[model samples]
Target: MDVEYFDYDNYTADIDSNLTTEGTLNLYSASSSSTYALVAVNIIICVLGLAGNSLVIWICGWKMKTTVITIWYISLAISNFLFCALLPFEVVYMITSHWPFGEGLCKLASSALFLNMHSSVFLLVLISTDRCIMVLFPVWSHNHRKVGKAFGAVILMWVLSAFLTVPSLMYRKTTVHGSVIQCHTDYGVRHKAVVLTRFICGFLIPILMIVFCCSVLAIKLRSLTHKSTKPYKIMAALILSFFACWVPYHTFVLLEIDFKKHNLEVIKTGLKVGATLAAANSFLSPVLYVFIGNDFKKTLRRSLSSRIEDALAEDIRTALR
Candidate 1:
């Protein structure tokens, strides 16, 4: 829902043709409050997300021994970090309603946003699937799940995410409407196809897979009376957080494909709010790891980095056993 990803082709021409000073002032006046609020929220998310995810990357990437779980956490942190790094451009765009970064950065920024979407969800699916395998066939998982295989899967996830983001690179354009420049996607005839592809590949299929894996893990744990439920609880929290953050963003995006049926202002506002929720998600994982990784008392006493390590170490060992 960054301005770079909005489809403004339909209205750019209208703005060009009907540019009265009064109308411009009215438009600015009406939207300025919300725009400023969004800018503030974006800045906050960018700062916190960068800090939190950087800690996660450093702790998981360097401080801990390399393992399959570390690989997943590091990859996920990298994706979120990259997205947060690019969010300032979006903040500037939202404030000025202009894109001075030229066409290439426009495409890159837009593509990066979608790349985060695809990679994050795909990684979640992989994590869930890995958990399921560990739960149902601990011996097989312990024997076959290697750090090299996790690296291979991470590579494949990035490649697939990049492939899916090609449409953003192709369609994102910078256009001049009066003196202001805008960065937006111009999908032309393929808008529906592109949006549908994002919904299905980025959200629907991956979420379903996550749900199925979690369900299986839940049922398996339920049957084993002696097994601790902490791992299942942790995985459940992750899946639920993911679903909560992404559902609104994807719902508004899907609605946008046929935005005519809904109120236009409502759609735009929904998109903005949904986008804010999505942005907040980049920071939520590290916080979740800090607080939910251990009990409240232990988390309070432990160093932040050690908390993350301990959180993963305990549950990961339990799952593999």
Candidate 2:
């Protein structure tokens, strides 16, 4: 919506007295009211994701026998966990509806954003390819698909992802909209250009390749109809889960541009809701690990549940004192 929505004319009815020509125009718009909800949700997510991801790292790195595939997924999960740790700032931004964090963070946040943008798809693609190789050439996989090779592949994937997302870092900025300062990337009309580029380069292209690779693997691996093939099902779920989470987010981003031109009440409400649902995606990734862990996590979690509950109870009791 550019900065017009916060201008004297549109907002004069609600906040005429707050206006200041010389002072910073506080950009707190109606949208900034998601503060309390954002704060609570963010804290919960960060705590859970940090604890869960730490558990995953401990399990994969120390407890389990080292496999190349385990090493790859562990890295991906750790990255996701770290990125979610930064959710507190986003929560703060949503709650206070102010960018009090400053311009440097605003730019830095864009770089952090690149991690999420590339990590999910690339990891999924890697998993699919890894499976395909395992299925199609079972004997060849043992000799070749070593931990070192998986590590090399992950490095290459990240380099390509980082190269594509460098543009986002370049475009992001903290802009004053009113009493609420917000961080976003603005390429003006060139936004559409970036969207198309991302669709082709970031999303559409990778997704198609993943599907194709999986289909080939599934067909070739029909002979080895054993329990080991279940990982592909989990991988399939991950790919679709990624799509389910992100499509709405990207759709809302486009809808926001439209919302600027016409602030219809219905559209605004839809955008607001969509924005919340999109935020939920950030928290959903760690949950996906449970679905993949068929027997191991369930048994371990059940055994530990009581002791963990006792510890939690003790912490609450101490806090109350």
Candidate 3:
């Protein structure tokens, strides 16, 4: 996710010139209304994501039984929650065009965003693949799947995500661009390589794996004696929401790699909008659970916490039988 920095065209020039006081004031004065609008949207997403994901963490982590499914949901919610928690720093930078936090935090905040991306996608892949395996080999799954193993998988995913986020940590820094302290990634000559790696490793491969798992699950579920579509619906909702939220952001990120060839204004607008959409994904899973879990109408009559519990309580094994 590209930090919504100042207009890159003048940004570079201003920095190169070692912005004079007049230039700094002019840059501050030139702030656009659309930037504020995007900040507003980000604030809204931050609040909702914190609330929704906190609820999921509470219910799944504390109220529900520790099953493999609950473990997956908890890990996902934790990632989203941590990312949302850092939004205030980003929001401050977006509004003031300055990073008040020091360089250490600048790096951490930037890396955390990618950490959430990698961890979330990896968890989704794990969920889909786990479900596929359960459907294909119920006996083996029943015999072997344990909460400890689920915890182990979650740990491995987070470690791998942290490993992938090293680029962000290495490249993200706070540079005094005139009066403004800007926190941005400086990939130097390797910008394209880093962006492409993120797209392929972070987005492309995981999405393909998810699609394949979902396809296999769909086909296998069709031949089962009991034809309940609830699990399929839940998985489909998760996959679709992931695709919808991420595709735009990745599209803009790729476009940005060759931004010199494209309209800078259009690319900037797309990036701001794309980033807002991506941030909104943090809360989407909890909303999906509430609306798509069990019988919606019946769940609505219960307490919200109970409804969420019911959602997490869904067992894929039951559907197989």
Candidate 4:
């Protein structure tokens, strides 16, 4: 997209030399009123997402066995939980229609929000690929896909994610303008570092991983017979749902980039809707993921009836004793 710049003197002082406010600068003409409404919706999504994901954490944490899927869910729940923790700040930012969190919080909130926000997509990609390996090559999965190894992979993901997001940590700050402050990334040139980071960690890598893994799984299921089709159907549904849910989001990112290039109004609507759909990803997974692969489904089903009964029975016996 060709770039356009507007003079942002109202929001611009000596301090805000590089900063630009949308309305003050007439930056692409996004309505503040509409942005506030989406902010409200985002808050609701965050709350529901937090509650459901927290339940996933509780169910998986104390009860489930250490397996590849469980490890991934733990990674997921932690990220979502932290993501929710940062919601009120953004909610306040939106409700007031300004950035009230201040300069330090601008960096802190942006880092916390995005570190976990974007990391989740990559982690999920890792999970899908991990499961595909399990299905396509059981022996290899058994040999290599242990909980300890999964932990290592998660740690690496965080390190890489942090590295990718260094620009946000370094340049993110609050832009104060005529009694209003807003949190934003303060990249001057939108350099290769920022652009590539946005593309790779945010969009390209995770989507490719998901698409490839799901494609492989689809092929594997096609190669199976009628007797094996039932479980594969459910697995296929779960996998397909993941892809379906993410499409709106990924498409939105592409559309946003396109719109930013052309400054198209129509694509902006899709982009907004797509981002909302993406935010809902945190909530959707807890339900879909409760049954995706071998270990999680088996362990969840196994624990469903017996583990609780046994625990209660043990408690009763203890009381009698």
* Tens-place lDDT digits, model 3, residues 158-263: 9999988898898777768668786766666666777788889999999999989989988987897876776667677877887898898889778876655787
**TM-score of each candidate?**
0.89, 0.74, 0.89, 0.71
Better of 3 and 4 by TM-score: 3
Ranking by TM-score: 1, 3, 2, 4
Candidate 1 lDDT, 148-201, residue by residue in tens: 999999999999999999988987778777897767766656767777888888
Say what the RMSD of model 3 is: 3.7
Show model 2 residue runs off by greater than 4 Å: 1-35, 176-181, 223-228, 254-279, 282-285, 291-321
Q: What is candidate 1's CA lDDT for residue 18?
A: 29
Candidate 1: regions farther than 4 A off: 1-30, 293-298
State the lDDT at 130 in candidate 2: 75
Cα lDDT tens digits for candidate 4, 271-290: 55665565556566555544
- Give the clashing residue pairs of candidate 2, or none: 26-178, 26-179, 26-180, 27-178, 27-179, 27-180, 28-179, 28-180, 35-95
In model 2, the worst 10-residue window by lDDT is: 1-10
